[model samples]
Target: MSVPHAKLPAWAEYGLIPLVNLAVAFLISGLVVLIVGESPLEAAYHMINGAFGRGEYIGFTLYYTTTFIFTGLAVAVAFHCGLFNIGGEGQAYIGGIGVALACLSFDRVLPWYLLFPIAVIGAAFFGALWAMIPGWLQAKRGSHIVITTIMFNFIAASLMNYLLNRVFKPLGSMSLETRTFETGGQLPKLDWLMSIFGLSVGNAPFNISFLLALLAAFGVWVLIWRTKLGYEMRTMGHSPAAARYAGIKEAKIIVITMMISGALAGMMALNPIMGEQFRMQLDFVQGAGFVGIAVALIGRSHPAGIIPAALLFGMLYQGGAEISFEMPSISRDMIVIIQGLVILFAGALEHMFRPAITRIIFGLSPKGRQAAATKGA
Candidate 1:
């Protein structure tokens, strides 16, 4: 039997704790900057300016944010079902195949408005299918999801490499990518959205897919909080034995949850495929799938939390580039260290301050007071 833990107030759990962790991360990062003989304040100023300085900068930041949102939500959904899915990279890779096929088939005959829905379906289907096999093995064959998912990512990369080189590459092109899509296959930029803020999108690739990512986040919120299946998922996540006793089908839920997670990951391909690249390219995921893990961790596996968490990473990525450019002494490796520190505090060390926080808040309730006393003893 497990001892019940004291719960923090919603404000502290959701807001204060995360803020504390972020502050610590920045402090450590500042120390590193100082050790390297640069002013942390100046580096921070440049980072902020780089990520949000111009209309184009903001657009690029949001573009990266859009990809992170889909992948972050993917990880979050599986987390709610008590599963860790590390195969978002592979799922997104396979999903590119679906997007490419759809665009190649209809680019000449159909307008983007008509093709977009088909591409969405194709991306979702392929992504879900790729994820289902691992879920099935975990459910029926006792395979570990983390191990299997990791293996699948390697498999996916190999499969895509073969397909691109032998199958999809156009004749005599001497390139690993397919033919670029025509106008009908390309998604329109969300210049109107930028204009509303009196900003121009400029050459940034922010597009309709950003809006789609926001809608998907809203849909995930409804699914996790409003639907009956979501209740079962949460219950299972809390305790598999209890969920089983309550008549929730564990096997079915696992498969479905994995599929949903994969579909969201697969949709990540849409941002690069239609919104920016306008064609499938090698390794276009650019490690966003792995970044999703950190995003979900920082977000606490909630859609509402996931959005801002995604934006934070977006800022890190865009700003890291600026730091490298403006402060050559800082170096790209130094920027990576800053990001790694944030992930370390926000993810691996998330609970480092929890005990102290609980002690501070534990006196408000008789139960909490008793628990604190019991812990002290």
Candidate 2:
């Protein structure tokens, strides 16, 4: 059956579905909190306070937001391209190697100014390279990307173990091969940013990576909406035959999109290697590639939609940590329970809420719409 075409204003279509999903995600989170024998209301308030009420807290939350955006954008892009590029874990693993090598190579040879960009570009390229082979296989051999990428994930994990054990192993350490970046290779303090606010180290990890994530999100928005390439991707996603009929090369675009997707995943290195930590280690990220799927679902596969979704994940994750520390009775795994429920609701919101969940406006109410229109006019 041909899909019925329903074109709402971009705001109504993309904006509405995600807003509905967000409400559902939060509701699920709340119920989980209640089930944990905690007051949902108080837990939520504490979560918000831990995330943003204090200056340091905001920085930390942004720290989580930065990398989640990278991995989530990776997943979102592949979803739009009609490909489930599930190899984000592997790509990120490979990227860690790239960043580590770049940091090591440039440490004595280059200045901090040049080394940072070098490391970022190197990480992204390596990430893209890791993803390209599976993309090629899918396009050429009609392989299932999900299966291929999952296999590659094992390969990536194995490769990480090998490299840390052999190639990148610091001479003395046998414990999982984590080596610190040379001082020059380390990400510099955001003295310049903090200088402006007169709040030195307001948040240690809230560095330039946050700015880059926001820019990348905006860039993804423009790429998917304003660019011809993105339109082709969306078309391919909806109907590959129609896309081919429209003169789009499905194979080429698929491979390219996966490369971009993997590259975005590789950018995950920055969250750990370029923040206060300044080096990539195996556990620097935690199942980020997998969680990215949840992020994309919650974000409704739109770039702008990703922001709050990531922030929500960040808050729960941060709150989970604080809760574990303070309560002693609760463990961090409880947050995982909340996250699992949120994902369930976001994924099944339509079934859960049915029709009435249809007409909710999140940030843009009717009054806000009029204000926006009047201002634009």
Q: Which residue window of length 10 is worst by lDDT in model 2? A: 354-363
The lowest-lDDT stretch of 10 consecutive residues in candidate 1 is 1-10
Our model 1 lands, by Cα RMSD against the true structure, at 2.4
Candidate 2 total steric clashes: 0
The sequence of per-residue lDDT tens digits that candidate 2 reaches over residues 120-209 is 898889899999999999999999999999999999888888877887777887677557777767765555765576555565577776
TM-score of each: 0.93, 0.86
Instruction: Give the alpha carbon lDDT tens digit for every residue of 302-352 in model 1.
Output: 988999999988888888778889998887566467557767987888888
Model 2 lDDT, residue 206, Cα: 71
Candidate 2's error at 74, in angstroms?
A: 0.8
Clashes of each: 0, 0
Highest TM-score model number: 1
Question: Distance (Å) between predicted and true CA of 175, model 2?
Answer: 2.0
